[model samples]
Target: MRATIALALAAALAAATSASGQDLLLRGGPIHTGEAQVEALAVKDGKVAFAGRLDAARRAAPGAREIDLKGAAAYPGFVDAHAHLSGIGFREMTLNLEGATSIEDLVARLKAWDEAHPGREALSGRGWIETHWPERRFPTRADLDRAVANRPVVLTRADGHALVANSAMLALAGVTAATAAPEGGQILKDAAGQPTGMLIDNAMALVRAKVPPPDGAARAEAVRRGAGVYAARGWTGLHNMAASREEVATEEALARQGLLPVRVENYMSLAEGGEVLASGPSRDGAGMVGVRGVKLFMDGALGSRGAALLAPYADAEGTGLIVTPPQVIAQALARARTSGAQVAIHAIGDRGNRLVLDAYQQAFAGDPAALKAARWRVEHAQILSPEDLPRFAELGVIASMQPSHAIGDLYFAPARLGPERLKGAYAWESLLHTGAALAGGSDAPVEKGDPLVEFYAAAYRHDLAGRSGPDWRPQEAVSRAQALAMLTSGPAFAAGREAELGALTVGRTADISVFSVDLLSAPFDQIAKAHAVMTIVGGKVVYEAAR
Candidate 1:
């Protein structure tokens, strides 16, 4: 039966290829329409015109240019529901320490980067996780001083919730032994009360404020470079989770210049929400960019031990820190409500998730209708208590999760949360069954932003190395079809773009992702080998892999 279908598709594609330019006619391979199986698709004026048989598509758009996909499978272009575009760009331009396996290795890499860069005002980079290190200890100022004593340096953890600064950087920020930890942040100190140069949550902001902010030109370039990277990786759209007014301006500038390769739905930062919202939500002419939501950080990440857990960590005495007090979050929600903006809160630990839920509940009391319509999200949603699991669906909160985080954090999550809490960690299938939407992302600069990596992790529920043991909780694994939805329709619905994007339906946007291998049937390990052969957005080919 499959062979007979393949022959029919070949004949149709031959007819399509025999025609000249009109728009686009894609056939000769599997086409996932996000509804049911389809033999082919046609695009006209940046929107799908036909999505059934090739003969019908040709009739719908006569003389359309044809692109035979060969045997590669095509699906709706993947959406990264949450990611940091500027950060991903900066990681490429700066000293990326994600490869360091030990404290010494990190320092050595930094020293080499410093030597190559020559005269920089300050050295700044991200992508280091202490959990994976051989020493399993956070790098201190003294350790960084060994590499460069005269200059300032701040290296962020892969989770982006914590950072380690050199003494020079700390001194510039005026962090001293007497400095008291902020209400929702912590500055780790030594036994004798000296600052240890490790800053978690809001504390990192002190040192960050001292570093020079990138200029407008640099930020514009970063957006361009980042879009290219995502396009090449098969992403047609992303919800840029953190954008300030200046960054949005840069994005608009890039859009005007016709340099953006992917679509962006930007969420203004909670801190800068008022200013960014003054002009109201902005969308570019081509719908390449939209700034209509607000992003808030409720707590730090789990890896830094600052995730505001309901119970104390198995290895530590106290629970984690709440980066943003509930009162502050409530205020942000109130402000966002006035502007009719969607809210996306970063909540990792169970306690963090509870606090955010409580805030959302309070915010929706006066306007229950908004609650259902808002489509608010809980970013990370990494660790949820059994009780809080149902509240996500009940409250209409989308769970914006990153599959790679499961693979990355699962290595040490057992040590941090112990066995019982592990049940709720990165529970993708569990969350889906609870009736909540699951929007997946890479959180690039936090992990390698690859669609295949995210899909593999979601489908297999194991680390890239496949080193999981018996207690690793494979029950949370999602099926390949579910994984694909999390990357496509799930995100499009979360962003309220389901009507226009996320499917190869007639009249929908012409965005598609063609892969070298069929993800639905690929072997677990072979999934990683699948490459994006083509990425199309708005009826234009944005990326095509070299032969």
Candidate 2:
């Protein structure tokens, strides 16, 4: 079945190619083939036939159509190891609060959105961080109510683990001050014990359940729009974490129509792991979509103090909340194991990471060989103790991570987690040195889903402005080469796709990311400012910057 899908996809790409056909010669100044230097590449039937000197490439594919890169550098098309495919599209289509600088800014933006789209049953968006706001606190439900009264509104924090609901939204969810928080969630209350409309982790689901689900048309549009956004930034593929079954079907359906611009590995939500497994591993349409993994959340994020932590947060009064209990994690892992599906669990804090590790171990203990082969991952393996750092490689688990989280979290992590615990936070280098592989991502819609931003964070270990302090942990900074690997091969490994993707090797898909500057040797600022000149997926030019 997999072979059939691969062939079908190749045929689709071949059909898309011009009269020159499937044979092509691509010559560029420098090509980072995830190894030694390469000057040119030959593509045949959407796969790399050769990657070496121009003469050798030409010899390998005689009479092939030629494309001159004109001094641009080529690298493996980047893979976002973790991100929400549908959410990114929705973010573009809905009210975007990513730029709101304060609570007032956020409310103002919501008001403007309300005015623009009057009579909306609900106003939904993401990308607001209260940490950077002048108020330095989450906005209450009253705040949102004041901006757009009567209509329900729910705006997610940048971390995606929490959201502030307007009074109407709260009422729709039937949540009030008297309503107790869920097992692994919180409903922030006022001094007088009135509901604040702030929901964390499981609590957010209450109001979220009431939001109208997007129709098929909306999902299809999101796929098209989001693909273009990633392609423009040079992404050849992305790991769609927490994709619903409907989303998986939507992407596959789009792929069938040759509308999918990039490859997608759909990690369907673990809540539906059984159904995904029953459907089995399959690819369809342009063969640009794959369904073989499940995404599970073990805890919330730190910004909201919902991430399960071993110790109480320095600024908050509690350790953290475990969104998914240990027993549930164990059961999910076991179920995923039976289906031979890869599992990626979201574990953000020390306690969360610890519990997930335990669950994975317990599930894998029964069948050691299966465990070794599963390539199971812990998404956002962000915080950990030194004792648990080595367990990743030891257990053969991949650390699916997002570097953007580090720079964003650095702003307030010091206050949330004291100086002592800071060392174990965002320990990228530490995890690498311990023999664990790191898969880089942006967690898009949660952060700016830009590969350059993620690379800057990993390579520089500082905020976007080059700001860093003792607590920023400069020692964890990785070399640029390492950073690139994290974005490319690292993610490929996590997806179990290193054999065919990640590198510009012979027989691999001709997916390439062309940039204006060499990311490895260029100045830090140039690397940051570097623009993608072109992006090719399966040897087909998906994006080309205007000359």
Tens-digit lDDT string for candidate 1 (65-132): 88898988899989998899988777777778886889999999889988988775889989988787
Question: What is the TM-score of each predicted model, taking all chains together?
Answer: 0.93, 0.94
Candidate 2 lDDT at 166 equals: 92
Query: Any residue pairs clashing in model 1, and if so which?
Result: none
Which portions of model 2 miss their true places by more than 4 Å? 1-21, 278-280, 366-369
State each model's CA lDDT, in order.
0.84, 0.83
- Give the range where candidate 1 is weakest over 10 consecutive residues by summed lDDT: 12-21
Model 2 misses residue 274 by how many Å?
Answer: 1.6
Give per-residue lDDT, candidate 2, residue 121. 85
RMSD of 1: 6.2
